[model samples]
Each structure stands twice: as structure tokens, then as C-alpha cells.
Target chain A: MGPIMDLTIFGFLVQDGLTTGAVYILLAVSLVMVFTVTRIVLVPQGEFVAFATLTLAGLERGDAPGLAWLLVAAGVLAFVMDLSAARRRGSRRGIAAAAVLFLAVPAVLAAVALYGIGASTPLAAKIAVTCAMVVALGPILYRVAFQPMAAASPLYLLIAAIALHFVLVGAGLYLFGPEGVRTSPLLDGSTEVLSMPVSVQTLLILAASLGLNLALFAFFGFTLQGKALRATAVNRRGAELVGVSADYAGQLTFALAAAIGALSGVLIGPVTTIYYDSGFLLGLKGFVGAIIGGLAAYPAAAVGALLVGLLEAFSSFWASAYKEVIVFTLIVPVLLWRSLAHVAVEEDHD
Target chain B: MNRRNKSACAAVLMGLSCLAAGSAQADITVGVIISATGPAASVGVTQQRTVPLLPKEIGGERVNYIVLDDASDTTTTVKQAKKLISDDKVDVLLGPSLTPNSLALIDQMAETGTPMISLAGSGAIVEPVDDKRRWVFKTPQSDGQMARAIIQHMTSQGIRSVGFISFNDAYGEGWAASFRSLAEQVGIKIVASERYQRTDTSVTGQTLKLISANPDAVFIAASGTPAVLPQATLVERGFRKPIYQTHGVANNDFLRVGGKNVEGTLLPGGPVLVAEQLPDSHPAKAPSLEFIRLYEALPNAGMRSTFAAYLWDASLILKAAVPEALKTAKPGAPAFRAALRDAIEGVKDVVATNGVYSMSASDHLGLDSRSRVMIRIENGGWRLVP
Candidate 1:
């Protein structure tokens, strides 16, 4: 047994829980958004987080980020697919637009990431470039791997998502190597609250999570584009008939997911060490949070993720060896409860 | 009478043809199983890179190395081992970079009557001198040896109680078991012990628990970059006591990832880590420097790793034993493999990168206390703790 639990220890554990929980919350929100829109579980959501951090570290080291080259590769694939699709349509009306979006954008980003950045580059710019490179990967991947299968069942989409997760993990290893990296902290010092030390990085994480969630809330509630996305989520065919392009909504949703994942990487990079495979576990934790909402409600998912963080924190204190087991075991009870509660509304549909 | 004479003639011809076939092929084959692409890639990649640098011609006979990637999976290791032994008919086997994979290989080695030099750092691979482990040997110092060094240093420093944290895996469990048994002999009590996963983002709770115990020192038994988190977390939480880590963090990446937070930490590692700092009279100095020079000459080799040295030492063992084995039997024969195993066992005081190995029937891992060096993290580099 450890020392008797005291208030100071409790305070520190809470702080640790909230900080990690915040990152999971961002992941959960993005997951919910992507799932509702595309009917895909977005299993590789954590790869984006891993890639963003590794790319940022690469930029800081003056090594050309590998994701930039990956972006270019994905762009080339998407471009070829677009050209073939256009040929089938018997008209080249949008050929130029497709070329610019699917080819030129990625090439430009890759060039900037490879040659423009250096160790002397400012931190903010480095983060921006990392996000841009990672964000570019999303829509191109959606175009190449997902859009053609858009009409498939959610089961197949989930399978495809899991496959994509593995590809990204392999690519991550190729880009970042097997070494784990920890970036320089965005905020370096700490302040004491109730005699418990709270790192500035933790504070930064909380603020970023709160701000991103609020922004997302406002986007979904007020903006016309947001409504279109919501419309697509409500009913894909209905939204397509009402002048909301399904392709546009899907791409936009993927871009949002990528952005949230990238931002989470940036915030969490300084707080802990991250490797190419680290995101799978982190993303799985967020998936647990999303499941707590039955994969729908935003607030419930956020609260569930926070609870996971707290439980992980406290459990690690008492039984660090079984922390993961305890955290993952949470989903079984939640699933059972949801199954019982929603039994009446159950209906079999693709 | 005519039928018996005809059968005798046929038997004589078959014996002559077999002798001719054995004499025609004079090359030796050594199969290497490395985890070049998975969780153990850091260790495997280095060992793989060292492959080309091994002796191409041992004892005037050509040596061929067939390297296969196990991807750090135990099942793959067994599959590859079978392929190497049954298909390739390798004379000896090397590596399978992780502990569990190495343990999985003992049965295959024993079944095939092959000698194996494992690069994994656990004593379980070669301990007990059982029928299965007799064919297995390893280059890395056992966790028990490193634990003894750390305990000796603690005793001399007047440290009474210690805190312990390690990864929740085979490697950590091995260290915990070894350290627990060894530390008890010295009357040093463990005030607290905790385990964390390799991919864990934070160890705040573990750190808090360890701090509350108020031990004289904290020892973390983990390897690679994952080992950095607990020390960094402890330092961030304002723990000023000395922290001891296992030899797993001897690589350059650990220093790069840990940065300033790792300063003043101490660990016991192979002599390869502080080769240049050793006294000139030390036996391992010259070979260690030679390994560093050769490894650094490779393009994009980065820093010299202890894991690579393990492979280099394995090569040295082969170079010394091949001639003896060749003297007894022809290459590509079961008799030749049996001879090679015996030759390796009889090897004595052969100088190489990590230490001078002296193998015997009872001991396969032939390094002594001279193989380990006390290291302190200072000024972003390893400093020999005098």
C-alpha cells in the first residue's frame, strides 16, 4: 500500500486526469462528428494525432517531415482516381478544379514542409505547417478510399477504417522511425493551487480543449455550412436532394476531424512522450468515451471521457499494472446499460 | 555368393559419394532472426545493421548470414526459427531481439541440435543449464548482473530503502524478480513498487505514490525511450533524490527525448556506453573503440548502440569457434553442427566489444562484472561513474 490518500495528492491526480481527459474529449467530438456524417467509426483518428506531433517534432529538428511526402502520394492517388472518374462522366468540366485540389495543393504543402521550415522556424508556424500537412491527408484519403464506398453498410466502412488505421500506423513508423519523441513544452513553468503543483502545459491543454469545443458548438448551432453538415448527418439522401452536396459534407467532416486530431497532438505533445503507435491506445480511450454516448450525444461523450481520465488517474495510483484493464473494462458495463435502455427502439438497418 | 558381392559393391560406392558430397561444399551458414520492424525495432535495427560488418570469412571458410525479420512477434520468431533450421539448415542461429521471442526459440534450437546466440537481455534464456537452454546463449548482460551492480553502488552510497517502477511486461517482470531477490541479500527494502505501460502518457499517480514512500532512491527498470517518462514526471513533481534506471536507456535517443530532466540520473550499462572513458588498461577498451569506429563509418549509422555491440561480439565468437568446429567435421553436416556447439562451449577469454567472453559447459553467457560500467547522465552524455 502507498501513503494515506491526502487532499494534495487528490488535487494533483485530478489535474492530471483533466489534462489527459481534455485531449480525449477533442478526439471524442471529432469521432462523433465523423461517425454521424459518414457512418464510419473513424478508427484511425489517433493516427492524425500521432502524425501531427511527429511532424511538428520533425520540423523542429529541421528534418523534412515524412507526412509531407505521404500527402503528395495520397494526392497523386486521388488525382488519378478523379481523372478516371471524369473520363467516365464523358465531360471534363471540373478537370482543372480537381487538378488544383488533388495535386497542386499537396505538392505546394510538401514543398513548403520539406524546404521552407528549419530549426529556426517559429513554433507557431511549425505547428501551422504540421496541421496543414496532416489536414491535407484527410480529404484526399476520403476521396480515394471512402467516397467510392460511400453507399456501403457501416460494418464495411468500419472494416475499411480499421484497415486504414493499420496503413497509417505503418506509414507513421516509416516517417517517424521507432523512436518516441517529446517536444519542447509550449508553457514551461508550473503554479501551485492548494499546495499542489499544476504545470502550465496542463492549463494550456484545458484552455485549448474548452475553446475548441465551444467553437465546434457554435459552428454546428449557427453557421449555414454547419447546418448543411448537420443535414447530411440527419439523412445523407435528404441532404443531397436539398442542395447540400454529399461529397462536400463528407470532405468537410473529414477535414474537421483531422483538424481536431492535429490540435490534440499539438497540445498533448509537450505533456508526454508520444510514438507512432501511441495514438492507437489514446484514440481507443476516446472511442470508449464516444461509446458512452452510444456514439451520438456530445455532452455525454465528453463527460464519459473525463470520467475515464479520472478513473485512470486514481487506478494508476492504486494499481498501476492494471490501469489499462480497469479503464477498458468500463466499456462493458456502459454497453450493457445502453443495450438495456435502447432495447425498445432497436431496429435492424444497414 | 554373387548377390552378396553385388550388395557390398553398392555400399562402398554410396559411402564414397557421400564423402565427395561433404567435401565439395565448404561454406558455413548462420541464420539471424531480428525484430527489424516492430516494437523491438530499435534494438533489432541496430543488430541488423551490424550484420554486414561481421566477418565474411571465418577461419578460411566462407560464412553466409541469412537475416529474417520477426517483427517482434513471438509466433513469427518460431516460424522463422523453423524455416532457418529446417529449410536453410543454418549451422547456428543469432538473435530474435526480444526476451519472449528468444525464450520461444529454445525448443526449436534444442530440437534441431543448433547453437544460438540470443541478443535479448534476460537471463532466463540461458539459465538453469537444462537440456533445452544448453543450445542457447546470449550476449547481453543478464538483468540479475545489472541489478547486482546497482545494489553494490547503493550499498556503498549508504542507501537503505529504494522505490521501484518498471514497465508491466516480461522485461520489467524479469528485472523486478531479479532485483527483489538480490536487494534482499543486502538488507535494502523496497519502500514502494509500481508498474506502468510502455505507451502510457503520464505516470503522475505512480510518481505521487513513489514520492509519498520517501525512499532513499528510485530505480526504474525499463528500456528505450519509454523509460524517460517516469523520471521526467518525478523531476517535474519536484523530487530531488537520485534516480536509477536500468541499462535499457543507454541509447542516444533516450538522451534526446529526456533532455535536461534526465540530468544527474544514474544507471548500470555495458562498457560500450562509456568505452572512451574506461581506463586504458581495461581489456574492453580497444575493442569497444574499434566497434565504435567501424559502426560510425556506416552511412547514417547515427550513434553507437550497445545492442549493435552484442552482435559484433557474436561475430567474434563465431570467428574463434569456426576453425575448431571445422577441424572436427565438414561443413553442412549434422556432425559439423554438433562440433560447432562444442567448440563454442570450449571458447575461452576471447576479446570482443562488450567484454572478454569465456564460455563453458555450465555457463553460456560468459561475461563477468567487468562487462558492466556505472554511468551517470551528465551534460547530455554518458559519464563513467568512477
Candidate 2:
């Protein structure tokens, strides 16, 4: 074969890379957030993405997804747990708050979902409901799976997260079946850039990713709750000593991660077909991006994800069979660099 | 003796008589292993659903089937095959959906002296007439056969050059190899070749490179829904040339997932996909329609797929073979398995849902060009083309 390099091909590859990289950036950022705050790898972050896309797809067909029921069930369980804890503490006000937030909110949402089934639902309503349902799952998952084990070591937390990942995948398969689904594009049409056509959906993904990153920046830099999360991330015991509840910070971080993952799902749902098991591979790619950032810096992770995407795009052109290998091999050097640069700190065993 | 002792002795005698009667007519068990929950799950799910459609009785003996999930993994397929042979003692084996899984189970099938009628498309599963492959047969048309149809179509359309993107696996490699050799014979140039993982989310870069090569058409060798990714990207990036797919994506899931982007794409598939559109005199028409009728009548059958038709054809082969095999030997014996394999190979001019099967010692696939027809996707449905 002869060399067939050209500017148009290069430009298109870049455009495609960026479109895919946008999703990875969101995932990498979420992974960084959850890992920093909770010390868990959050392996099932991609399940939230699949659920979001499938829920929107169901809504598009004028059917309510089983996700609504899952949310309500989780909510009721959490509510009952909170209610009992409040009762034991003799705090009536805490019980009321728990009931309204967990029980009332999910019940109303489920009612809305039931009403929308078999009736043509507006696109915006569908999008909102999909996003909200996926976001709601994060805290509930955290409460049910991680709360009791919050004080455990990172290894235990990782095992729990991995187990949750498998369970969620099984549930996703049971709920969605084995077929892959593709939703209608949020934006349709294309524009010529440098003699190369770019899709409107691609542009939307880029815009949404950038906008979310900016909003996250403001949240982390200015808000009190954000500061509390940062404090907990920096020093969990220190934050607890200073009256910042580590448990609350962990829940908040999980919610933000889930929201980011779901938003990423909605953004990319039209561009690719997603099966129930698709998210695991997608999330692993993002985890690779997170690893590239040393698992700490958000901006570094974002840039690293973009690089991973671009590498994958170009490598496919050069050697498509080994493209995955090329993309994953990038982590080796980053790991080597990090290990050489930083000294290892030994942890005390209990 | 007391009256109670006399009654117990009578009951024991009756139980022994029942056991003897059961031994005279034993049930024939067919073991099946398909990729029910992995990358090839879409194809396997369809094939799995067709199990219930199989005949309850074959060769005047009751038939029992034991199905297991391979999850699209080769190791799992081998394990399942072992379990079926040693534990279930199945008389015949049915499936393992994808090419790799089917290829992986060949040795085990031979060792166990059992016949496996695979649902995969790889010709290697039954080619070369090796000891291992002699025990193996497949329902789907071989990649070599489908490649000939595609090359014929391309040459007829005056296409001289084509690009290729295949999965980075055995299935893709098999098709690419066949297409390359066949295209070369027909004087068609393969301008570019690329491969991607089945789990890959994007193929834009590969599509870009192929577009740059400027082939008259592009052949995507991937299977299932993942096959749509590269083709969809090609259209999105303004590659207006004709695109072709193999028989792998001949199902409703591909159409549903590809949506409008796949409209007008061409591929070669079994006659069953367009059974209603085939000429009345076509050899596969009657059996194809019969399968469609029976399959569609099942509750929650959804759309009929060529993969399922392969299983339906397997059932037909087994129906014809079991009676002959039973005449020679009893079930659960090595002689019975050998008899079954010989009977399947001796099947001649047997019309099936996919095509007329004429298995022989040297040729196990038994499918010819008559089994394949070119199809185009138009208006979200398959349209037959000359």
C-alpha cells in the first residue's frame, strides 16, 4: 500500500476524535471526582450512561422504562432506612426530611412516568426525566452499597464497586434485553468545515461537555458544599474532625459523577449504538484516561482523555487492528512516569 | 407369606418391567451451546429462540435438548461442549453462534464422537475434511460462497476497486481472506484494508482513510450491530460510494440500530431473508416460507432473522438423520453418534430453509450459490436484487 495522507482526512479524523473525546472527558472527570472523594473506582459509572440512553429510547417509543420503578424501589428502601435511623435518634424533623426527599420525590416522579407511558411525551420532558432518573440512582446506590462500608479500606471499596458493576450490568440486561438501541439525534444536519462535513450532534456534544466542565469548575471553586467536598478529598479524617461529614461529601460526589455520566450518555446516544454491556468497555476507556491523569487532576484527565481519543482515531487509520492496543499502551508510560516521579507511601494495617 | 409381603413383591416386579420398557425406546438428547449473552448475543438470541420451534419427536423417538450459554467465549464453548458430552450425553450438538466459538469446539466434537451442526459462517468449521471437521457441520453459507456473490454483484455493477474494514477477529479475517482472493480472481483491486474490535465505538479514522483511498465501494466485514458503526461513520463523513456488508448483519437488530443510515446498502444473504420475494421456482422458496410461517406464529417472535433460519435448517437435517442413525444403534452410545454423523453426511438434495443440503464426506457445508441472493435495504426492509 502507498502513503495516502491528506489534509482533509487529517481534519476529519481530528473532528471525529474530538467528538468521541468529549464523552471520555466527561467520564474521566467523573471518575476523578468519585475516586478523590470516596476512594472507590466507581466501575459502574458507564451503567448509568446506558440506563440514561435506554430510558430516553423507551420514552421516544412512548413507553416508560423500568428505570422509574428501580428508582422508586431504591428510594423507598433508603427512606425506610433513614426513617428508622431518625427514630432511633429521636429526631422527628430528620424523619420528615428523609421521607420527603426519598419517598415523596421518587413517588411523584414515578407517577409522572406512569402517566407518560402509552402517551406521547415531549422530547424535553423525556430528556429531563431520563437525566433525573439516572442522577437519582447515584445517591441511592451509594447509600445502599457504600454507606455501611464507608469506613473500610480502599481495597474493600473497590471490590464492592466491582460487585455493584456486575449486578448493575445483570439488571441492565434483564431490563433492556440483549439488543442494542440507538436513539434519535438531539441535533440533525451537518456543516462544512475545511471542506469536511461536521455533524450537528457532534457540535452539541462538544458544547455540552465544555459547558458542564465550566459549571463544575464554578461549583468546586466557589460553593461551600464544593469546598467541603474538596476538604474531604484532601483529608477525610481532617474534614471529619472539622465537622464536615465525609459521608455527605461521598454522596454528593457520587451524584455529580452520575449526572456527568448520564449527560454524556444522552449526548452520545445518537452517535453510537449502545448495548447493555457496552458501557463497561466505554467506562474502561475513560478509566484509562483517568489513569493518564495520575487519578487526581481534573484538567489533566480531560486533556489525557482527548489525547487518548485522538490517538485511537489516528491509530485506526494507521493500523486499525491494533488501535485498541495503541490507545491502551499509552497508560504504561504515564504509570511509569508517575511512579518514577513520586515516592510510594506505605499504609498502616489495622 | 403375609399379604403385605406379596403386595411389595408385585410392585417391585412392575417397576422392573417399566425400566425394561423405557430402555427399549430411549430419548435422544441434542445439546446446544450459543452465545446468549456476549458480543454475539444478538445472533445467538435469535438462534436460541428457534429451539422451541424444533420438532418434539425425531426418528420415532422423543427428543430432549439441553442448551447452554457460551457468552461468545471460546473457552466457555469448549467447556460447554465437554459438559454436554460427558454429563448430558447428547446424541447431537447444535450451535455456538460465532465463527471463533464454532472453530474452538471442533476438536472436542471429534474427541467425543459427536456431530455439531454449527450456526457460524466460517467455512473452516467444516472444510478440508479433517478428522475434527468431519465431526462438524454448519448451517450458514460459507464466507467463500458469500464472497463470490458479492464479487459477482460488484463486477456486474462495473466496480473495479473496493475498500475493506473487518472485525479484528476470526470472522472478519475469514471474510476478508475470501473477498481478497475472489476479488483478485475477478480483477477487482482492494484499495485499502482496516480492522476494528467488535466492541469499538467509532470507526471514523478508518473510514477516513478508506475514503481517501477512493475505492468504488467499501466492504464492512464486521457482524451484528457493531457492523453499523463503521458504515454509519462512512456516510456521516461524506463517503457517497456504494457500501457493502456481509451476511452477518442480515437481521432486524442491524436495521433498527442502523436506522436511516443503512438505507440502500447492499449485501448477500440466504434466500430466507427475502423468502417472499424469491421466484416461485427457486429451490429454497417453499422451505423458507414454511420456516417464516412457523417462526412468525410463535408469540414474541419479533422479526425473522437468517441466524434463526440456520437453526431451523439444522433441525431439518437432524430430523432426516436421526431415523437412519436410530436404525443402526441405540442412544447414549459411541456407535449412535458415529451413525448420526454418517447419516448427516449422507443427506442428499434435502431442501432446507436456507438451501438444499447435500452433505458428503469431503464437503460438509453443502450450501451452493443457489442458497445465496443479493439483498438491498430499502425503506427499512430487505429488497431482492438481481
Candidate 3:
């Protein structure tokens, strides 16, 4: 025990694992919440966060300190997009398509603004162009096409949405190449910024990430749109009879889910290097974590992610190669066990 | 009369098809069993990305790189290798990256006598299971060399007693055993040794197991995201003891995922980017830099790694071996390929733009003690420690 008490790399590894796990936890929980409300698993949740992070971080990151207002504005727009999608209860595929476009809007706007900055265009002109495009074209198109599509089943729709996300990412990769990462710099000269021992900044990054997710959830839960979403989720006919406007509520929930997916991508981008495939992997992990948490339970998925992280850390130390194999193997057995137990309980009830 | 006409038509059609096939045999075919997906797909992707840029001036002749995706699976590797050889009739071969896949191909290599080179890691890939077979050659150092390098570096830094953390696979087990042997040879003791399976991500039990027995430095012999990131977890928890990493975990992706936790970790040097910044007189510096510059210009590729230096040398050796095909064997494709193999086998002391490389009948390992350089992370970048 005394010798064990001496410092070791595995100890440090466990700590790092926890930190990364914390980030995963948030993603897992958000995904789980969306799944719980809609009954459709949002398998694409991970990719959404990655894309949103890339979108925001891809903005004029050099001036990000001053563009605090931009984030607020983007968040509100994203939230509105969420509400609209929630109002729609269209086919899963159509909703997914609409959601993909909704997420892309911010990234495109951010890209245009950043491109303008790079090309020596005046800030006012960039913002003017951005605002005009977003308002004049973005909302009009979204209202017509995406709003209805989103109200459909959230589960299968989640998968379709993520596949659409991959296409967008692929397009971005084709257009940006390696420079896409550079065009808007995810973090302000990461080497310098990351080096500064401002634990406060790290805390803020983590806190803001968590807070934004929670705040969005709160908006959905506390607001009238959120109430409508609940009514649609629990029972459509009853909610409609209660004058809840079930169709509108459906659209609002889809819109909210899309917004969450987009904002998540924005927050995650600065933490890791973005690539065409980044979204897909994150989406999968988030989906898995969501499932582990019973889909409807946000806090459970959060815990599941931390569990994944902790397991990952331990697995690396013990069986590095089998880390993934072990996690998946356990997942299947656990699920099988649960299914068997459920059957047994049903038999007892009979 | 109708039957005769039909028979005549069939004969003519078959004859024409055969003639067309022979007419299209202008390009030399070379097969690469590359990993297009899975964990090590990045390495395979890098190879696919880099191999095409070899100029015709260097390649002697442009060959159809019949790259078949192995999916990083053994069955896929075997099937792809068979198809390339039997179906594609490839002139030369490269890669089936992982150890098990490489080992699986040994009997095939011996039977076919195919002169193959791998753009893979796994010290055991080229090492003979039996002395009669010497057809395989590996571009990277063997496990023995890697273990020696790790032990030597750690001991020199006064890390006498080290902890062992490795995956329980062929790759990991081989390294773990070799490391213990190498460490014991140098009078270094391994205090705590723990083994874990590949898929288990929560190493809490394992890490706790290792930390419980604690040693001076911990040797993490692992690869891919699942294996490497846990080291970061250990570091962040304030474990300051020297955490020495295997050569496998020395890439940018690993460093990126590990972040500051990797700042002080030591990595065995395979090739450093400093070679690019150096002048001509410095052995490998000039040629390495030239390759980097040329490779950077490849569409969608850039100058990103120090390891690409070895690849440059590997291509150069193969290129220089081409002239032997003209001299020793006949002028045609098949004979020239036969000569190319012999020339490669006979290569010795050919001063590459980098350092002196010697290849022969018995010697598979390229460089001796002078070649195995070591480096450590200072401020998020790898720096050679004197």
C-alpha cells in the first residue's frame, strides 16, 4: 500500500479520464433527455454537438472575447429553431432533413462572417450580410419546409438527421480542406490560450457547456412551447382536445431538438480537432449513453457517460486493446439481462 | 449449317477477349492490403495518402497500386492478398499492417516467395518464425529494439523500478514480455504488472491495481484512442512520476487526445521533424526535408509528421532496387520484378539521404544503437533530451 501510495501514471490517467468523461456525460444526458421526451432515440445527438461547436468556434475566434453578444444571439436563434421543429410532427426523414438545414444555417452564417473578416471586409458589412441572409431567407425557408417536418417521431428522425449532418460535414470538408479548421480557429490560438493556467477559463468552458445544455432544456421544460411538447409526447389526442395545438407542439419539440443538436456541435468543436467523421462518432457515443440512461432520463445518461469515461480510463490501464470490445460486450449482456429480468417480472405479475 | 455458325461465333468472341486482355497488360500491378476502416485506419489512410506521391522518376515504372481494403481484419487481409496475387497478379506487395494479419501471411509469403514490404509497426512482422524464410522485411524496428530503447532510456533517467500496464493481446503481450526481459537485462526491475482486456474502458480496477503496487516509472504499451487516453486520466490526477510511453503512442492524434497529460511523458524517437530543419551535412536531415516538402504538395495532404521521414527512405530504397531488375533479370515486367527482389535482398550500406542503411540475407533490422534516438515532451512538443 505504501508503494502503491507513490505516484503513478495510471492515477493521472484516471483524473484525465474523469474530465473527458464529464464532457461525455453532458452529451449523453442531453441525448437521453431528447429521447425520453420524443420516444424516438436521437442517435445523432453527438454529431449535433460537434457541429454546433464547430459552427460557433469557427466564427471569428480571434475576436470571440468581444463577440459574447454573438453567442447569445446565436443561442436565441437556435432555441427558436428548436421550437419550430418541435411544432412539426412530419415523417422522421423529413424532420431529419429540416433539422440538418436548421443546424447548417448558423454554421453558414458564422462562416460568412468569418470569411468576410479574413477577406478584409468591414465588420458592419459582414454582419449586415449575415443578418439579412438569416432573416430574409433563413426564416422564410425554414418556416415553409422544416417547421412541419420536425414534428415527426424524434427517434428514427434522430438517425436521419445525423446522416444529413455527415453530408453537411462532408461538404464543409470539401470546401474547407484543412483550412476549415484554420479559417475560423476553433480556440483563439489554442497553444497560448490553453497554456494560460487560468483554471477559471477551463471552469468557464465546462460550466458554460453544461449551463447552455441545461438552460436549453429548461426553456423546453418551463415555457409554453415546452408544455405543449410534453402534451404531445404523453398523448397527442388528449393534448389536442385540451387546445394544446398538438401539431404546433410537435413542430416545437423537433425545432428544440434540432437547436440542441446544433448548439452541442458548436460547444464541442473547440475541445477537439474537427473532421468530416467527427460528428458520426460523437453521435453514436451520445446515442449509446442516452440509451444507457433509459432515453427519457437526462441525468441517467449523464451518469452513463461518466461511467463510460471511467470505464474507458480503467480499461486502457488494464486491457488497452480490448477497451472498446469490453464496453460493447458488457452493454449487450447488460441489455440482455435486463430484458430477461423484465420478462421474469411480467411472468410473476401474470 | 446454323450449329456451325454458332460455334464459329463463340470461338471468335473468346479469341478476341483473350487478345484484348493481353493488350491491356501495360501497367505493372502492386497490391496493398491497407486498413480502410477500424481503429488503425488512420495509419492505413496515411499510407494510402502518401504512397501515390512517389514520382515516376523514383518508382522506375508507375504500377497500378491495387489497394484492397482489409478492414483491419485477418480474414479480409488473407482474402485481399489472395485476390491481389491470384486475380490482379500484382508484381510486388505492401502491408497487412497489424501483427496477427502479418503473421497469417508468413506461410503464404514463404510458399509464393513474394518479396513484400509492410508500412506497419510490430517488430515481429519481419522476424522469421523459421530461418528458411527471409522473404519479409519490416520498415520499423523490432519489438526487441523497442524494448531495449524503452529500458535504456528509462534506466538512464534513473527510473530503476518501473510499472507495467499493457493490453492483453498479441501486440501488448509480446511487448510486455520483451520489456521485462530487456529491463531485467539492464538491471531495471518491474514492480507491478497488470493486464486488462481490449474492450474494457473503465480501467478503475486495473489502474487501482497498478497504482497499488507503484513503481518509479510506468511503461504504457498501448495504441488507439481507447488505450492512449487513459494515460491522460492518470496524469491529470497528479501522478508526476516519469510516465514513459511506447513508440506506438507517439503520433499527433494521441498527443492531441492526451493533451497536457502528455506534456512530460517520454516517447522513444523513431524520427524527429528536426531533421527537416537541419542542413545537408546532418545525415538524414536533407533528404527527409525534401520528401516532406514534396509530400506537402500532394492534394489534401500536408507536412504533418516526423514519421513520414521513414516512409521517404523506404520508398527510396525500393526505388534504388529497381535498377537491379534491368541488370540481373530480363527486360520484361515479370523478370524485372524478380531482379528487383534479388537487388533488394542484396542491398547493403546504401547511404540514403538520411543515414546509412544496410540490407542483406540475414540482417533485417536496419540500424544499430546510433539510430535509436529518444525524446521527451517539454511544452506540448517533443524535444530530444541530451
Show where candidate 2 strays beyond 4 Å.
A80-93, A117-119, A192-196, A343-350, B1-41, B56-90, B96-101, B323-336
For model 1, residues B261-332, the per-residue Cα lDDT tens digits are 999989998998899999998889999999999998987788998999998998888888889999999877
Report every candidate's CA lDDT: 0.87, 0.85, 0.56
Winner of 1 and 2 under DockQ: 1
Candidate 2 global Cα RMSD: 5.9
For candidate 3, what is the DockQ? 0.12
Ranking by lDDT: 1, 2, 3
Query: In terms of TM-score, which candidate is stronger, 1 or 2?
Result: 1
Per residue, candidate 1 scores C-alpha lDDT tens digits across A296-323 of 8899999988988899999999899999
TM-score against truth, every candidate = 0.93, 0.90, 0.67
Residue A36 lDDT in candidate 2:
85
Mark the 10 consecutive residues where model 1 chain B has the least summed lDDT: B13-22
Question: Could you tell me the lDDT of residue B272 within candidate 1?
Answer: 84
Off by over 4 Å in 1: A91-95, A344-350, B1-24, B86-88
lDDT of 2 by residue, A6-61 (tens): 88778878988898898999999999999888889989999989888888887787
Error of 1 at B43 (Å): 1.9
